[model samples]
Target chain A: MLKVIAQDFIRHEFLETVRPLYQELVEKTRQEKECVSYHLFTDQKDPGYFIFIEEWPDRAALDAHCQTEHFRRLVPLIDSYQTREGTFLLMDAFSAAADS
Target chain B: MLKVIAQDFIRHEFLETVRPLYQELVEKTRQEKECVSYHLFTDQKDPGYFIFIEEWPDRAALDAHCQTEHFRRLVPLIDSYQTREGTFLLMDAFSAAADS
Candidate 1:
Protein backbone atom coordinates (compact mmCIF):
# COMPACT_ATOMS: atom_id res chain seq x y z
CA MET A 1 0.00 0.00 0.00
CA LEU A 2 1.03 3.60 -0.49
CA LYS A 3 0.41 6.24 2.18
CA VAL A 4 0.62 9.92 1.31
CA ILE A 5 1.07 12.72 3.82
CA ALA A 6 0.26 15.98 2.02
CA GLN A 7 0.80 19.24 3.88
CA ASP A 8 -0.81 22.51 2.85
CA PHE A 9 -0.02 25.84 4.50
CA ILE A 10 -2.76 28.29 3.70
CA ARG A 11 -2.92 31.96 4.59
CA HIS A 12 -4.91 32.40 7.79
CA GLU A 13 -7.49 34.53 6.02
CA PHE A 14 -8.24 31.72 3.58
CA LEU A 15 -8.97 29.02 6.14
CA GLU A 16 -12.74 29.29 5.89
CA THR A 17 -12.58 29.69 2.12
CA VAL A 18 -10.62 26.46 1.67
CA ARG A 19 -12.36 24.19 4.19
CA PRO A 20 -15.56 23.29 2.35
CA LEU A 21 -13.65 22.71 -0.84
CA TYR A 22 -11.37 20.34 1.04
CA GLN A 23 -14.41 18.56 2.43
CA GLU A 24 -15.79 18.23 -1.07
CA LEU A 25 -12.46 16.95 -2.37
CA VAL A 26 -12.18 14.44 0.46
CA GLU A 27 -15.75 13.19 0.04
CA LYS A 28 -15.33 12.79 -3.70
CA THR A 29 -11.96 11.11 -3.36
CA ARG A 30 -13.25 8.62 -0.80
CA GLN A 31 -15.82 7.37 -3.29
CA GLU A 32 -13.17 6.32 -5.78
CA LYS A 33 -12.64 2.57 -6.03
CA GLU A 34 -8.91 2.98 -5.61
CA CYS A 35 -9.15 5.00 -2.44
CA VAL A 36 -8.61 2.90 0.63
CA SER A 37 -9.00 5.84 3.00
CA TYR A 38 -8.72 9.65 2.78
CA HIS A 39 -8.79 12.06 5.73
CA LEU A 40 -8.13 15.76 6.35
CA PHE A 41 -6.51 17.18 9.46
CA THR A 42 -5.78 20.75 10.57
CA ASP A 43 -2.90 21.71 12.82
CA GLN A 44 -4.16 22.35 16.34
CA LYS A 45 -1.87 25.36 16.80
CA ASP A 46 -2.16 26.70 13.24
CA PRO A 47 -5.62 26.30 11.81
CA GLY A 48 -4.33 27.35 8.40
CA TYR A 49 -2.06 24.33 8.14
CA PHE A 50 -3.84 21.24 6.76
CA ILE A 51 -2.73 17.71 6.19
CA PHE A 52 -4.28 15.00 4.07
CA ILE A 53 -3.50 11.44 5.13
CA GLU A 54 -4.42 9.14 2.27
CA GLU A 55 -4.05 5.47 1.49
CA TRP A 56 -4.09 3.72 -1.86
CA PRO A 57 -3.42 0.22 -3.04
CA ASP A 58 -0.36 1.33 -5.01
CA ARG A 59 1.27 4.08 -7.08
CA ALA A 60 -0.89 3.45 -10.13
CA ALA A 61 -4.03 4.02 -8.08
CA LEU A 62 -2.59 7.20 -6.61
CA ASP A 63 -1.60 8.52 -10.06
CA ALA A 64 -5.09 7.83 -11.33
CA HIS A 65 -6.54 9.74 -8.40
CA CYS A 66 -4.65 12.91 -9.36
CA GLN A 67 -6.18 12.74 -12.83
CA THR A 68 -9.72 12.47 -11.50
CA GLU A 69 -12.08 15.35 -12.24
CA HIS A 70 -12.50 16.48 -8.62
CA PHE A 71 -8.75 16.57 -8.09
CA ARG A 72 -8.12 18.68 -11.19
CA ARG A 73 -10.88 21.10 -10.27
CA LEU A 74 -10.20 21.52 -6.56
CA VAL A 75 -6.43 21.12 -6.09
CA PRO A 76 -5.33 24.12 -8.15
CA LEU A 77 -8.05 26.22 -6.56
CA ILE A 78 -6.85 25.06 -3.14
CA ASP A 79 -3.22 25.82 -4.01
CA SER A 80 -3.98 29.44 -4.88
CA TYR A 81 -4.63 30.20 -1.18
CA GLN A 82 -1.49 28.56 0.10
CA THR A 83 1.10 30.63 1.96
CA ARG A 84 3.82 28.35 0.58
CA GLU A 85 4.24 25.38 -1.67
CA GLY A 86 2.78 22.20 -0.21
CA THR A 87 4.75 19.13 0.81
CA PHE A 88 3.76 15.63 -0.33
CA LEU A 89 5.51 12.66 1.20
CA LEU A 90 4.93 9.35 -0.54
CA MET A 91 5.57 6.59 1.95
CA ASP A 92 5.31 2.89 2.66
CA ALA A 93 4.59 1.15 5.95
CA PHE A 94 7.80 0.56 7.86
CA SER A 95 6.56 -2.84 9.04
CA ALA A 96 4.34 -5.38 7.35
CA ALA A 97 2.32 -5.66 10.54
CA ALA A 98 1.36 -2.00 10.27
CA ASP A 99 -0.14 -2.65 6.84
CA SER A 100 -2.97 -4.59 8.45
CA MET B 1 -8.77 13.26 19.98
CA LEU B 2 -5.24 14.22 19.01
CA LYS B 3 -3.34 13.02 15.99
CA VAL B 4 0.41 13.47 15.80
CA ILE B 5 2.43 13.46 12.63
CA ALA B 6 6.05 13.04 13.62
CA GLN B 7 8.76 13.36 11.02
CA ASP B 8 12.20 11.97 11.81
CA PHE B 9 15.25 12.34 9.62
CA ILE B 10 17.61 9.55 10.52
CA ARG B 11 21.20 9.31 9.31
CA HIS B 12 21.50 6.72 6.55
CA GLU B 13 24.13 4.85 8.52
CA PHE B 14 21.73 4.53 11.45
CA LEU B 15 18.81 3.11 9.49
CA GLU B 16 19.70 -0.49 10.27
CA THR B 17 20.41 0.33 13.89
CA VAL B 18 17.15 2.23 14.38
CA ARG B 19 14.76 -0.13 12.61
CA PRO B 20 14.52 -2.67 15.40
CA LEU B 21 14.21 -0.02 18.05
CA TYR B 22 11.33 1.60 16.15
CA GLN B 23 9.68 -1.78 15.65
CA GLU B 24 9.94 -2.42 19.36
CA LEU B 25 8.56 1.00 20.13
CA VAL B 26 5.59 0.53 17.82
CA GLU B 27 4.75 -2.86 19.28
CA LYS B 28 4.89 -1.60 22.82
CA THR B 29 2.99 1.61 22.12
CA ARG B 30 0.10 -0.21 20.48
CA GLN B 31 -0.56 -1.93 23.79
CA GLU B 32 -1.16 1.32 25.65
CA LYS B 33 -4.82 1.87 26.65
CA GLU B 34 -4.82 5.49 25.58
CA CYS B 35 -3.33 4.79 22.17
CA VAL B 36 -6.10 4.84 19.60
CA SER B 37 -3.74 3.93 16.80
CA TYR B 38 -0.02 4.01 16.01
CA HIS B 39 1.72 3.34 12.74
CA LEU B 40 5.10 4.12 11.25
CA PHE B 41 6.00 4.89 7.67
CA THR B 42 9.21 5.36 5.70
CA ASP B 43 9.53 7.77 2.81
CA GLN B 44 9.49 5.85 -0.47
CA LYS B 45 12.25 7.97 -1.97
CA ASP B 46 14.29 8.53 1.19
CA PRO B 47 14.89 5.52 3.40
CA GLY B 48 16.32 7.72 6.14
CA TYR B 49 13.10 9.64 6.53
CA PHE B 50 10.43 8.09 8.78
CA ILE B 51 7.07 9.29 10.04
CA PHE B 52 4.91 8.22 12.91
CA ILE B 53 1.19 8.73 12.45
CA GLU B 54 -0.33 8.33 15.90
CA GLU B 55 -3.74 8.88 17.41
CA TRP B 56 -4.50 9.27 21.09
CA PRO B 57 -7.77 9.81 22.92
CA ASP B 58 -6.62 13.25 24.10
CA ARG B 59 -3.65 15.40 25.05
CA ALA B 60 -3.56 13.82 28.50
CA ALA B 61 -3.22 10.37 26.95
CA LEU B 62 -0.39 11.57 24.72
CA ASP B 63 1.37 13.19 27.68
CA ALA B 64 0.98 9.97 29.62
CA HIS B 65 2.46 8.10 26.65
CA CYS B 66 5.63 10.19 26.98
CA GLN B 67 5.89 9.15 30.59
CA THR B 68 5.69 5.44 29.84
CA GLU B 69 8.78 3.36 30.50
CA HIS B 70 9.08 2.12 26.93
CA PHE B 71 8.62 5.60 25.49
CA ARG B 72 11.13 7.14 27.89
CA ARG B 73 13.65 4.40 27.20
CA LEU B 74 13.31 4.29 23.43
CA VAL B 75 12.46 7.81 22.21
CA PRO B 76 15.63 9.48 23.43
CA LEU B 77 17.70 6.59 22.17
CA ILE B 78 15.90 6.91 18.86
CA ASP B 79 16.47 10.66 18.83
CA SER B 80 20.18 10.20 19.22
CA TYR B 81 20.32 8.58 15.78
CA GLN B 82 18.38 11.36 14.08
CA THR B 83 20.21 13.57 11.59
CA ARG B 84 18.03 16.47 12.64
CA GLU B 85 15.42 17.15 15.29
CA GLY B 86 12.09 15.58 14.48
CA THR B 87 9.03 17.61 13.54
CA PHE B 88 5.91 16.93 15.61
CA LEU B 89 2.65 18.38 14.41
CA LEU B 90 -0.25 18.16 16.83
CA MET B 91 -3.41 18.01 14.76
CA ASP B 92 -7.17 17.72 14.95
CA ALA B 93 -9.67 16.47 12.41
CA PHE B 94 -11.02 19.18 10.15
CA SER B 95 -14.37 17.48 9.63
CA ALA B 96 -16.15 15.32 12.15
CA ALA B 97 -17.26 13.02 9.34
CA ALA B 98 -13.67 11.95 8.71
CA ASP B 99 -13.12 10.88 12.30
CA SER B 100 -15.13 7.72 11.65
Candidate 2:
Protein backbone atom coordinates (compact mmCIF):
# COMPACT_ATOMS: atom_id res chain seq x y z
CA MET A 1 0.00 0.00 0.00
CA LEU A 2 1.02 3.60 -0.57
CA LYS A 3 0.72 5.82 2.48
CA VAL A 4 0.91 9.57 3.01
CA ILE A 5 1.31 11.57 6.17
CA ALA A 6 0.55 15.28 5.88
CA GLN A 7 0.64 18.00 8.49
CA ASP A 8 -0.69 21.59 8.60
CA PHE A 9 -1.14 24.40 11.05
CA ILE A 10 -4.30 26.42 10.64
CA ARG A 11 -4.54 30.11 11.42
CA HIS A 12 -6.20 30.71 14.78
CA GLU A 13 -9.17 32.50 13.29
CA PHE A 14 -9.71 30.01 10.49
CA LEU A 15 -10.18 26.80 12.48
CA GLU A 16 -13.96 26.79 12.24
CA THR A 17 -13.95 27.66 8.57
CA VAL A 18 -11.47 24.94 7.63
CA ARG A 19 -13.02 22.09 9.61
CA PRO A 20 -16.03 21.58 7.37
CA LEU A 21 -13.81 21.46 4.35
CA TYR A 22 -11.79 18.70 6.01
CA GLN A 23 -14.95 16.88 6.96
CA GLU A 24 -16.14 17.05 3.39
CA LEU A 25 -12.78 15.96 2.06
CA VAL A 26 -12.64 13.00 4.39
CA GLU A 27 -16.16 12.00 3.51
CA LYS A 28 -15.46 12.07 -0.20
CA THR A 29 -11.97 10.58 -0.09
CA ARG A 30 -13.16 7.56 1.86
CA GLN A 31 -15.59 6.75 -0.94
CA GLU A 32 -12.87 6.45 -3.58
CA LYS A 33 -12.19 2.92 -4.86
CA GLU A 34 -8.48 3.11 -4.18
CA CYS A 35 -8.69 4.60 -0.75
CA VAL A 36 -7.84 2.12 1.98
CA SER A 37 -8.37 4.62 4.79
CA TYR A 38 -8.17 8.34 5.55
CA HIS A 39 -8.00 10.13 8.85
CA LEU A 40 -7.78 13.72 10.14
CA PHE A 41 -6.41 14.48 13.59
CA THR A 42 -5.60 17.60 15.62
CA ASP A 43 -2.69 17.89 18.02
CA GLN A 44 -3.61 17.71 21.69
CA LYS A 45 -1.00 20.30 22.63
CA ASP A 46 -1.70 22.58 19.71
CA PRO A 47 -5.21 23.32 18.51
CA GLY A 48 -4.04 24.69 15.18
CA TYR A 49 -2.03 21.63 14.23
CA PHE A 50 -3.73 19.12 11.96
CA ILE A 51 -2.44 15.87 10.53
CA PHE A 52 -3.84 13.74 7.74
CA ILE A 53 -2.84 10.12 7.27
CA GLU A 54 -4.05 8.25 4.25
CA GLU A 55 -3.54 4.92 2.53
CA TRP A 56 -4.16 3.98 -1.08
CA PRO A 57 -3.60 0.88 -3.20
CA ASP A 58 -0.87 2.58 -5.25
CA ARG A 59 0.51 5.80 -6.76
CA ALA A 60 -1.96 5.70 -9.63
CA ALA A 61 -4.82 5.59 -7.18
CA LEU A 62 -3.44 8.55 -5.24
CA ASP A 63 -2.80 10.46 -8.45
CA ALA A 64 -6.38 9.89 -9.53
CA HIS A 65 -7.53 11.25 -6.20
CA CYS A 66 -5.59 14.49 -6.66
CA GLN A 67 -7.31 15.05 -10.01
CA THR A 68 -10.79 14.80 -8.56
CA GLU A 69 -12.95 17.95 -8.68
CA HIS A 70 -13.43 17.99 -4.92
CA PHE A 71 -9.71 17.68 -4.24
CA ARG A 72 -8.81 20.33 -6.81
CA ARG A 73 -11.31 22.70 -5.25
CA LEU A 74 -10.38 21.92 -1.67
CA VAL A 75 -6.63 22.48 -2.16
CA PRO A 76 -6.89 26.24 -2.71
CA LEU A 77 -9.18 26.75 0.28
CA ILE A 78 -6.95 24.60 2.52
CA ASP A 79 -3.93 26.66 1.49
CA SER A 80 -5.37 29.86 2.95
CA TYR A 81 -5.58 28.43 6.48
CA GLN A 82 -2.03 27.17 6.71
CA THR A 83 0.77 28.67 8.76
CA ARG A 84 3.15 27.14 6.26
CA GLU A 85 2.98 24.86 3.28
CA GLY A 86 1.97 21.45 4.62
CA THR A 87 4.47 18.60 4.88
CA PHE A 88 3.63 15.53 2.85
CA LEU A 89 5.56 12.33 3.34
CA LEU A 90 4.94 9.44 0.98
CA MET A 91 5.69 5.94 2.31
CA ASP A 92 5.48 2.25 1.41
CA ALA A 93 5.11 -0.63 3.84
CA PHE A 94 7.62 -3.45 4.27
CA SER A 95 6.13 -6.87 3.59
CA ALA A 96 6.27 -8.99 6.72
CA ALA A 97 5.31 -12.61 7.17
CA ALA A 98 2.80 -11.27 9.65
CA ASP A 99 1.06 -9.32 6.86
CA SER A 100 -0.21 -12.69 5.66
CA MET B 1 -10.33 10.32 20.89
CA LEU B 2 -6.61 10.28 21.63
CA LYS B 3 -4.31 9.70 18.73
CA VAL B 4 -0.59 9.08 18.43
CA ILE B 5 1.69 9.43 15.44
CA ALA B 6 5.05 7.79 16.01
CA GLN B 7 8.07 7.37 13.78
CA ASP B 8 11.18 5.19 13.86
CA PHE B 9 14.08 4.38 11.58
CA ILE B 10 15.48 0.93 12.01
CA ARG B 11 18.99 -0.28 11.25
CA HIS B 12 18.90 -1.86 7.81
CA GLU B 13 19.79 -5.31 9.07
CA PHE B 14 17.23 -5.22 11.85
CA LEU B 15 14.19 -4.73 9.62
CA GLU B 16 13.58 -8.46 9.30
CA THR B 17 14.00 -8.99 13.01
CA VAL B 18 11.59 -6.21 13.92
CA ARG B 19 8.69 -7.20 11.69
CA PRO B 20 7.34 -10.00 13.84
CA LEU B 21 7.47 -7.83 16.96
CA TYR B 22 5.46 -5.09 15.30
CA GLN B 23 3.02 -7.66 13.99
CA GLU B 24 2.59 -9.04 17.45
CA LEU B 25 2.15 -5.57 18.87
CA VAL B 26 -0.51 -4.66 16.32
CA GLU B 27 -2.37 -7.87 16.90
CA LYS B 28 -2.37 -7.52 20.66
CA THR B 29 -3.07 -3.80 20.68
CA ARG B 30 -6.13 -4.22 18.46
CA GLN B 31 -7.60 -6.60 20.98
CA GLU B 32 -7.43 -3.92 23.68
CA LYS B 33 -10.84 -2.46 24.60
CA GLU B 34 -9.50 1.07 24.24
CA CYS B 35 -8.01 0.64 20.79
CA VAL B 36 -10.08 2.21 18.04
CA SER B 37 -7.49 1.46 15.38
CA TYR B 38 -3.79 0.82 14.86
CA HIS B 39 -1.74 1.01 11.68
CA LEU B 40 1.86 0.48 10.66
CA PHE B 41 3.37 2.11 7.57
CA THR B 42 6.81 2.37 5.96
CA ASP B 43 8.24 5.21 3.89
CA GLN B 44 8.40 4.81 0.12
CA LYS B 45 11.80 6.42 -0.19
CA ASP B 46 13.34 4.82 2.87
CA PRO B 47 12.75 1.18 3.65
CA GLY B 48 14.03 1.62 7.18
CA TYR B 49 11.57 4.32 8.14
CA PHE B 50 8.42 3.18 9.93
CA ILE B 51 5.41 5.10 11.17
CA PHE B 52 2.65 4.08 13.49
CA ILE B 53 -0.75 5.71 13.72
CA GLU B 54 -3.00 4.69 16.56
CA GLU B 55 -6.26 5.75 18.15
CA TRP B 56 -7.79 5.10 21.55
CA PRO B 57 -10.96 6.14 23.32
CA ASP B 58 -9.10 8.33 25.83
CA ARG B 59 -5.86 8.96 27.68
CA ALA B 60 -6.78 6.52 30.41
CA ALA B 61 -7.08 3.77 27.88
CA LEU B 62 -3.69 4.60 26.35
CA ASP B 63 -2.11 4.80 29.76
CA ALA B 64 -3.43 1.36 30.52
CA HIS B 65 -2.18 0.18 27.14
CA CYS B 66 1.38 1.21 27.94
CA GLN B 67 1.19 -0.73 31.16
CA THR B 68 0.13 -3.93 29.44
CA GLU B 69 2.57 -6.83 29.67
CA HIS B 70 2.99 -7.21 25.94
CA PHE B 71 3.67 -3.52 25.39
CA ARG B 72 6.16 -3.42 28.23
CA ARG B 73 7.99 -6.38 26.74
CA LEU B 74 7.86 -5.04 23.19
CA VAL B 75 9.31 -1.60 23.94
CA PRO B 76 12.88 -2.65 24.57
CA LEU B 77 12.99 -4.97 21.57
CA ILE B 78 11.73 -2.17 19.36
CA ASP B 79 14.26 0.23 20.80
CA SER B 80 17.19 -1.98 19.89
CA TYR B 81 16.28 -1.80 16.20
CA GLN B 82 16.04 1.97 16.13
CA THR B 83 18.59 4.31 14.57
CA ARG B 84 17.51 7.04 16.94
CA GLU B 85 14.94 7.58 19.61
CA GLY B 86 11.49 7.59 18.00
CA THR B 87 9.14 10.56 17.87
CA PHE B 88 5.74 10.33 19.44
CA LEU B 89 3.22 13.07 18.83
CA LEU B 90 0.07 13.00 20.89
CA MET B 91 -3.09 14.40 19.38
CA ASP B 92 -6.81 14.79 19.95
CA ALA B 93 -9.51 14.94 17.30
CA PHE B 94 -11.53 18.11 16.99
CA SER B 95 -15.17 17.83 17.91
CA ALA B 96 -16.77 18.95 14.71
CA ALA B 97 -20.45 18.58 14.03
CA ALA B 98 -19.28 16.12 11.42
CA ASP B 99 -18.08 13.87 14.23
CA SER B 100 -21.70 13.39 15.11
Q: Give the candidate number with the greatest TM-score.
A: 1
Q: How would you encode candidate 1's per-residue C-alpha lDDT over B1-100 as one tens digit per residue?
A: 8999988999988787888899999999999988999999999898889999999999999999999999999999999999999999999988734322
What lDDT tens digits, residue by residue, belong to model 2 across residues A58-100? 8899899999988999977988888888888898664566432
Each candidate: how many clashes? 0, 3
lDDT of 2 by residue, B19-76 (tens): 9888888889899887898888888777778888888888899899999998999978
lDDT of 1 by residue, A1-100 (tens): 9999999999988777887889899989999998999989999888888999999999999999999999999999999999999999999899633322
The alpha-carbon lDDT assigned to residue B37 of candidate 2 equals: 83
- Relative to the unseen true structure, what is the C-alpha lDDT of residue B21 in candidate 1, on a scale of 0 to 100? 91
